[model samples]
Target: MLDASSNRINGSIPLKMGEQGNLNYLNLSNNVMSGIIPNDITLLPNLRLLDLSSNSFHGAVPVTKYSFSPLEIIDLSRNYLNGGIPVEICFIVTLTTLDLSNNSIGGQIPYCLDNLIKLTSLNLAYNNLNGQIPLSLVSLLEMNLLNNSLVAQVPDKYRYCFPAKAFVGNKKLCGNIKGLRHCDLPFFSIIMPLVPMSICIGASLFLYSKRFDQIEGPGIQLLCAFLPR
Candidate 1:
């Protein structure tokens, strides 16, 4: 186990760090490291608790064909990491706590994340992620998804477990969740379709009135002159 967290460790992770297969429980959180997370780190055979959060690491989360079967906890939050949450990470059946909050990560949260049946805590707040909250994630004991760009209705299953604060900052998101407006039609949206029809009706009425006056003008005047005074 190697713990070097909360340091001023700068620059990219060393590519050769994966060569040490025997090592486990690597924690380098709260550092000043910047650059792409080396892919080789995922190759570690005995790695269990990997924490690289609160750094400046950029680019996609690493994926590997070979499974990290023994791995459990993974925290890469509060970084500059962008791109989708890699599907490969979901294959680790042993994961319990996963945090990727406060990053610039975009794309939909992989539905495969539901396969992590062991996941109890998940934090994905303050990202660029968009999409509905997966119904499968409702089993988690703790979750936070605040300040994302996610849209669509919040699934009914999740409303009881997670509060409205977990889903705040997403302007497009609406549902039965408290503190969010209902997803029903707005006044402007409801009236938009009627606008063109109303204009057409008004135009037709004006034209009909003008046509009637033109056709009846001389006849009405001549009839009035001929009628008993």
Candidate 2:
């Protein structure tokens, strides 16, 4: 039972938090915490609810061997945390709710997220994450991935689950999402008109090139052959 919520606990979570093997509820939310969550926090074998949301922590979420197994609810939302979300958190395999919204986190959604076999809710909205939505997330009951930089088409497999608004603010994004603009490209823009003109000029020159060649060539040969004769 560790409650450091809504305080001025700036800087990283102290490494010693790991030694508390009996800690079940750890809430450090609504604080000024910064830096990576200590690698040692995972030592809390009994931790169930780890809430570190609404803070200023940066770097990847650290998960040790012990800390990741028993986690049920984790809220790390509304922070400045950046980098790819840890696959180890997905390894918990029993997460009911995981919130990571409103951050600067970037990179493609992890491929192993399907490992969250029991995840019910996942929030990753309003980040700088780019790349395609992972196909593995089809198992999720509800997911929020809006307002990111996700580009590319959402596969048809996930169309029934997520809507077009789930992928907003991504300029390069495309797919079957409704109301999203289809990527339009002018065919003539890439087809250079001058190339055909050049080909025609080349062909005309090739057919009539012998006339110019006759005028330019053999003058020295003619002079030498005639003079010697």
Model 1 C-alpha RMSD vs. true structure (Å) is 13.9
Please give the lDDT score for candidate 2: 0.72
Assess each prediction's global lDDT (C-alpha) against the native.
0.78, 0.72
**What TM-score does candidate 2 reach?**
0.72
Q: Residues 87-202, candidate 2, lDDT per residue (tens digit)?
A: 66667866789888998888888887777787888889998888777888888888888888887666777778877677667766666667565653333223323234323322
Query: What is the per-residue lDDT of model 1 for residues 9-76, given as tens digits with 9 covering 90 to 100?
Result: 98888888888798788899988998998777777888888899988999987657676647788888
- TM for every model, in the order presented, reads 0.78, 0.72
Best by TM-score: 1
lDDT of 1 at 145: 88
> Ten consecutive residues with minimal summed lDDT in candidate 2?
204-213
